[model samples]
Target: MITNEYINRAIDYILNHIDEEITVEDISNYCCFSRYYFSRIFKMETGESIYEFIKRVRMERSAFRLKVEKDRSITDIGSAYGYSSSNYSSAFKKHHNMPPYKFRRSIVHKSMMNPVFRNTQTELLTWQECSEKITVEIFEDCTVIFERYKGSYGDLSVHWGAFLDKYKEYITEQTRILERSYDDPAITLPDKCLCDICIDAPAGCTLENICTIKGGRFAVYHFSGPVEHIYSAYQNLFSVWLPQSKYKIDDSYGFEIYKKTDCGSRHMDIDICIPVK
Candidate 1:
């Protein structure tokens, strides 16, 4: 079996050298595994090919920087991630459906007009009043059976209901309801966002859409509020808390642990778990 430690090491190596040229052989050697074996195991564990993962990460990071580093030129941002101007524009447009210049302009325009975006910093300062509590905890690695959904975040409930109905047999007292969002709606178009609703399952559980959540240290922020406000909470987490905190974000995508959901009242209580180093 591929251990979490080995995967973590590989991920760490990737993040540290993301701008440099990385080869499958280099990663496989780092993990002390043969090329073919390492590639297969990595895909099995992470639900994506190594090259795809690297490309996606670089694109996402570039997207984030585009939003925050307003003064930086688009060409510089693209080059920083090892993409030339034309190639970067092509790759970014293909993934995000818009050019980098347009994406950055949209963020700036939205921030100016949207009250939620304008008040993110203030909201973060008073987050304790609206949130339950933030805590740091260690989580264990586990397997999950999930169903994927795409499109607007508002339509997730319909998908969740269907996923539960289809996989009710897997439900148990110990089963955790987890949601993994692969795209940032603020960066990527809402229609292109991808989410997965999942339930914890037994180890070695082979299902149609099974993935392993890499376990390690995480900063968990407990949030209790209307569903619409969740995005702001995340904005605060990334724009405010994370920048000020000593810990840096890890390679693993942060996920939400749903504790309670009441669609009738539009209330939710969830733990936003961000992987940290």
Candidate 2:
């Protein structure tokens, strides 16, 4: 969990409202602090000024949409964040070193080379085998306390361990360990990935780093395998199964609900839930 309540509140405001026009004054006022004081603490803790942080996050989220939401026009995606077509192209080029259309092209081209498309003799399972693991279900909305992590997904074990240890006193047998991913690993750079290591809010927990996961209809895949193969599982779910299914993905962020884990055995059991329309 983020230790600074003010910074957490500011980040929360930014993330929850990133698609809308945002300003430093809006965040400062939301946290009930002066703009100068809030900006100083935000930079001190996050290593980026409030404006820089907001811009980077907005750009990254928009970049992800460019890759996945192929049917969405660049102008519409930019307009969601209050950017006009010309301004959006300029800002996107400045940060990503390419225009939005070019970035989308690059990701799509790269996706064709994924391991899922490779031919192998008895080395890869059939598409039907992979699709069989997915099922549809309705997920109820829930609030959780989470800590933000910005790095490779492989480093998550350490972060999860630390979170559990730090809040052990508040944890019980009923606690649910879960995570929410903000970027697609295959599309986004490894170091720039963002995720939240979370658990269901503890009893009487007063943590400020809390948010609600949207409840909706989802395609749930029950994945049980080595931690390293988790990414492959997601690829199969999205690339192979999704295209054939009647449903299309919704705008909601997907989350993983941990069923169990075996550190010594190097195994993980979890339900990967993707919201669908």
Candidate 3:
């Protein structure tokens, strides 16, 4: 993960205004570095040039919206990212290997609320169990230091351990460990997923990779089980409970606050929080 404050600021800007037009020159100037130098170091630390990273994030987030915001029209979704309908379809197909409509269709069919489906992949929660575990709650904004990791979600424990170890000095009784995921696993390929393992930062800490987590309304589910069982919780949460709820998921991004962790047992006590409107 990059500890460069300049790159961190640039990434924050990109995510905040992902719906708006962005250019390398704009980001370079915002970081107060020459465009060439900023681009070079960003690529060196992130493995993707500035434009490539922005494009990938836009594509992933748009694809995620396709899954969640089913009532929203494709044209409107594409337009939000400054893509014309035709261009969006072409680009989405090239990036995801299928047109946007098909991708949405597949998700609908795949996530049918089969009682048996919950038993298999999720291996933990029935509809009733999930219903009992979830609630709508408000969250306060927090500043956090995070390490962005890209790749398979199933293999993140080692990365988490290393990051926590590196920043061990900052840990405290009141601190919270959070994991903010930026892509839908069902849509984005496992190797291409992006996430951050983060912890609350103290005031005026001056950490290099720090950013504010803008908090608001959230559907927070309390879960305690083997980490493998989490798949079912999420499936049941979004596929079942969320659709029936009065609230709609907003674009603020969902995150997990780890209340307890036992990596050796592959177990966790975590609050799964998804932003809502």
Candidate 4:
């Protein structure tokens, strides 16, 4: 079996050098293993060939930048991830079933046709059911180590449980437990949604998976109730309060800050922090 340390070092190398050209031989050298042996071990552990994994990660990163960085050119974004313009467009089209430009356009179109926009009238009528006060605050940037999960939002508890168990030793009084959902469930398919279960890590701490949450203005809503009701609270925030507010939701991922949980009572208190501009 391949050792965890070897796999972790390889992953770290890939993440850190994603913007540069990387090859199987380079990874093998970094791990101080033969190329043939490393390739087999990597595939066994990650379920993908090293080349396949690199391509997928680059495409995912490109898709994210295409959606958020409206001012950047598609060609520039493609080149940053080590792809020529033509090759990037062709690969992106094959992977996403649409051209990059088309994909970017779809984002704007989807936002307009979002569930929140369509149900604004009905949401206004039932807004009282979720009438919770929202507060605006300036949040500082945070460094977090996270585990990514892709599936139905309802299944996050399973992921969270596993994450806590795996990283229990890293837990501390100052470590903040948070979840960042990258895609809007209302706009994307439930099974395709991307979510990350993260914990704030101290500076200079290196991990297998880490990302920086950008700091900015945010609209915070506090919810204290059964976990099932959390969806309704979000629906009210997006469909009701957001449309009527002065600020517009930004492109950054929205996160949930877990405050307290009562297993016996099946209740939880969490703050939903949505980035705003």
Candidate 5:
């Protein structure tokens, strides 16, 4: 079983130094373990690596900053989050693709789309009991562009791929003018309707250009995992765990929190937040 002591101590260190250079070695020394041993245990328990975990913590903080701190420049914000000039560029490129400056203008000013879920199946399934500390928050109304989908989500990568390619192109063109992003909320998957969630997009964006998608309110949850196994977490949450919890499922947006995606670590750092009532 995973102990709260271990998780809590790690979290405390992480929260304190979110803006500092963090590594497996730092965590190892803090926890009094060898780097090799700490890496294995963290992966085994969280399904993610130490480096990936820290990057995620940083990215999450950045996201909030982006939403609230309009005064900070992207480079300033990036550096505040412990990213070097090159590192910030690389990280922003991987996540937002068009760099922070342009991406900022689009998200900050727009009326973002929010998806809402009205009804859910009554049947409840049992899952292995495990709880991770999750923080929940509410976002006000906003604007967005999105693409709607319904199908076997596992095989829908082709669709997402096409959408991403177009989204990137749109951002490149509009970067000089505004900050544009392809927001993905990966809810409505297979097993039930085999559905795919929509993408929040920007203006000058069209189906051909990957423009405006949808906008709405959301109740978000953060977690970490490999990209492939992420679906299992959702399955457990929606089908088994959430049904019994006090939180009611709403038809807003559902999205994954992302950290790094590179050869060094394929473990996807994600926050799976679904808008609920």
Candidate 6:
């Protein structure tokens, strides 16, 4: 099994070299493990190969930079992330589905078109190595309103809207509100496609549409990026990061914490929390 020490160190290395070329051998050396062993453990733990993870991270980072640094052009931003030319735009388009220039202009108009939440922007997405650790507290038992659907996250909009509609009514009668996802199944990958809706309620609150999510030990990761890039975080956590983590995955749901522009940064911020044993 991959140990936590190696995963943590590998993440640190990747963050420090986000703008440079990296290889599995580089990571293996850092972990003091043979390349073959490291690769096996990495793939078994994280759902993605090492190369795909690196590319996804780079794309996520570049996308964030494009939004924050408005003065730079698409080509310049791509190059800074090591894209050879604007043609790299094709990869971005496939990943994000919209051109960089268009994405930037939409941001300029002060529209709700947040690049972080948008999955349609075109360009090889870039990842900004987030070294920040998430803060999580343990609670014995919490009630969460949830809905389960079996399908692709790519098609989650319709089902999610239905769940929200049901939740809105429940919230109207409540005082405090909190939300999360339970993805013990890791829906971002095809192998596992379970999803859940979670909310925190008062100690004596009525169950109503709410179901109880047994709270235990949980490890949390905080990230800001397009929703499409969420998978990269999972790849890092479950594939590379988790293998090396001391904790093991617990069966539950993985949910995202969405930041509304009115309350948080204009960018979409999501937290991937998993119940760990």
RMSD (CA, Å), candidate 6 to true, equals 15.1
Alpha-carbon local distance difference test for all models: 0.74, 0.79, 0.81, 0.73, 0.50, 0.55
| CA displacement after TM-score superposition, residue 190 of candidate 1 (Å) | 0.5
Q: Residue 64 lDDT in model 3?
A: 73
Residue-wise C-alpha lDDT for candidate 6, range 1-277, written one tens digit per residue: 1224465456547745877888989988989999888777766655556676677667666765565444557788788778866666877776666777765555323322223234443232122232244445454666665554433555565565666676665554453333443221221233333344445555666654455556676667776765565655654554444444556554343455554322233254766666677
Candidate 6 TM-score, C-alpha based: 0.43
* lDDT, model 4, position 74: 99
Per-candidate clash tally? 0, 0, 1, 0, 37, 35
Top lDDT model: 3
Error of 2 at 182 (Å): 2.2
The model with the greater lDDT, 1 or 2, is 2
Which is superior by lDDT, 4 or 6?
Answer: 4
Best by TM-score: 3
Off by over 4 Å in 2: 109-130, 186-192, 206-211, 237-248
Give the lDDT of residue 111 in candidate 6: 27
Question: Per-residue alpha-carbon lDDT of model 1 for 127-190, expressed as tens digits?
Answer: 4532346678999987888666546776788888888888888888888999977666666555
**Per-prediction RMSD in angstroms?**
7.6, 4.0, 3.6, 7.1, 21.1, 15.1
The digit string of per-residue lDDT tens for model 3 on 1-277 reads: 5567787778878887898999999999999999999999999977889999899889888887777777789989999999999999999999988899998888755644333223445443455776789988999998998888777777778798888899999999998999998766665666767788999998789867887788899998898988766666676676667766777888688899998888679789999999999
Which is better, 5 or 6, measured by lDDT? 6
TM-score, candidate 4, is: 0.58
